[model samples]
Structures are given as structure tokens and as C-alpha cells.
Target: MSIASAIVLFMVIWFMTFLIVIPFRIDTQGDLGEIVPGTHAGSPQNHHLKKKAWITTGITLVLWVIIGGTIVSGVISVRDIDLFGRMGPEGSMWHSESGSAAE
Candidate 1:
């Protein structure tokens, strides 16, 4: 693949990673139950947990962005190609005796 293609692939992978890392909250009860429920029920702990979860999520996102950017840039600089290139006859044994095989 080309450098551009590699960058695009990385972006897609990063997006998927972001989606998977973020947590979702579901409320089975109505708003009244959420605000003030009966005894032995859920409490403000959920809110606190959600806040901490968001903080951790934000940190993870920043770290991934930095790491991914570094890796993509390094790969682009070193390989000069985004993805692996097709192998020639010298690199692969599948070529015919006539050496006419092509990618």
C-alpha cells in the first residue's frame, strides 16, 4: 500500500479504537427514579463513576493520538510506503521458469 493508504488505514483503526474505548450508560428507570429512588436503590455512585470513566477515556484518547501519530510518521519516513509492496521474482519463489509472472 501507498503512504496515503496507510494513513487512511491508521485513521480507520484509530476511530474504531476510540469507539470501543468509550463507555455507554443506560438508564432502565425513568428520570424520577434516577434523581431520587427508594431505599436500597442506586445512588450518586453511578455519576461519580461516569465522571471518572470520562476522565480516563480522555487520557486514553490523548495517549493514543500521540502514539499513533508517532508510529505513522515513523513508518512513513522509514518505509517510504504505507503498506507492504508486491514481491518480485527474486523475492518470491512462485514465479514461473519464464519469469513472466506479474503482480
Candidate 2:
């Protein structure tokens, strides 16, 4: 993939990981019996956002490396997922196996 696509993929992965990790090990106001006067009890008392962001970045980097390597090495390609026969030399986009376009 191009650098732009790789960057976008990394961003998406990082955000997804961040959201998934946000609730882990959180200290909610209600859980600690320190609910602020007006805020909801479920509000996080110590979100540790910076730490979580770093962890998310690390996880995303590892995932990106594996995915990028697979893509670069051609372990998986677009034709591998063309379940409807819409691509490749013998698919809809090209000559079919019967050498007919109508098929």
C-alpha cells in the first residue's frame, strides 16, 4: 500500500485500540465513592489518557507492521478476496474462463 493508505490505516487502528482500552482499569467516581457534586457517578476519576494513548500507539504499530508486511509480501491481495469474480484475468473485468464476456 501507499504511504498515505498506511498512515490512514494506522490512525484508524490507533483510534479503535484507544477506544477499546479506555474502559480498562478505569477508576470511576461511583466505583470509588467520590462522585463529584454535579457530574455523573460513572465519570472516570483517572482516565490515564496519556498512558492509554501510548499503549494504543504501540499496539497499533505492531498490528500495522504485521499487516504491512503481509501486504508487501503478497501474502494477501485484492484478488484473494474477489469472491464474486469481479477481478483478475479470468473474472468479470477481463476474459472469463469460457472466453466470453456475456458470461
Q: Evaluated with TM-score, which candidate comes out highest?
A: 2
Residues 1-103, model 1: lDDT tens digits:
4678656655665556556644445333353365545644433324345555565566666765666677656744433452553343345656555566565
TM-score of each: 0.29, 0.82
lDDT of every model, 2 decimals: 0.54, 0.87
Q: Lowest summed-lDDT stretch of 10 residues in model 2?
A: 88-97
- Candidate 2: residue 5 Cα off by (Å): 1.4
Instruction: Flag regions of model 2 displaced more than 4 Å.
Output: 88-103
Q: Which runs of model 1 end up more than 4 angstroms from their true locations? A: 1-47, 75-103
Winner by lDDT = 2
Tens digit of per-residue lDDT, candidate 2, span 1-103: 8999899888998899899998898999999999889999999999999999999999999999998889889989898898987564733465655676665
